[model samples]
Target: MSASGLPMRLRVPSDARFRPILLTMARRVAESVGFSAADAAAVGQELAARTDAVTRKAPLAETTPIDVTFDVANTNGAVFRVRARCGGSDLEVTRPLPLA
Candidate 1:
């Protein structure tokens, strides 16, 4: 992971069915990068919910794909940025994730 937090990417089909896989990846990445256990879990849970919400609202075709991009805004006190995009629709959420 980068200085602030997230440093990963996940791409999956644009269906709601893939949310669990995304959550698992988010949790593992957050924890591996030194986020506190609870914080990591929270981040994962929040991401999953947010992604699902976005998916539900988006008018995506079944063939379209979704992408989850994790990034840090800056090297110092950077916030974790989660961007989910599907079928040209997108949603962004940020978190000031805590260090372990």
Candidate 2:
């Protein structure tokens, strides 16, 4: 669980092949917030796209451990945020722009 107790986390080796697992995790998180199955899946794909892009370019990623954290918020209605972290770097995706 995450700080808000409504999060799911996956820790895996920093390898491209494991990206799918992370994406699956994201999809489930999105659906938890009421996204339709297809929309939730799209969110997962987007999360994977951004995460893969970041991890591929991260320094020493091939050897670093990565942690993907998924969270859903209900404060102002449903919102989702996912973070893929390696060492001190963070790659994050969130629904509903903070300023929107």
Tell me each candidate's RMSD, in Å, in order: 2.7, 4.3
Q: Compute each candidate's TM-score over C-alphas.
A: 0.76, 0.74
Q: Write the per-residue lDDT of candidate 1 for residues 1-100, one digit (tens) a residue.
A: 6554445787888666777888887777767666777877888888888767766776676656778887767646656677888776777767775654
Candidate 2's residue-wise lDDT over 13-94, tens digit each?
7777777787787777677666778877888898778766766565555657778887766667656778778767788777
Candidate 1 stretches with Cα past 4 Å from truth are 2-7
lDDT of 1 at 2: 59
Give residue 50's error in model 1 in angstroms.
1.5
What is the Å distance of residue 56 in model 2 from its true position?
A: 2.2
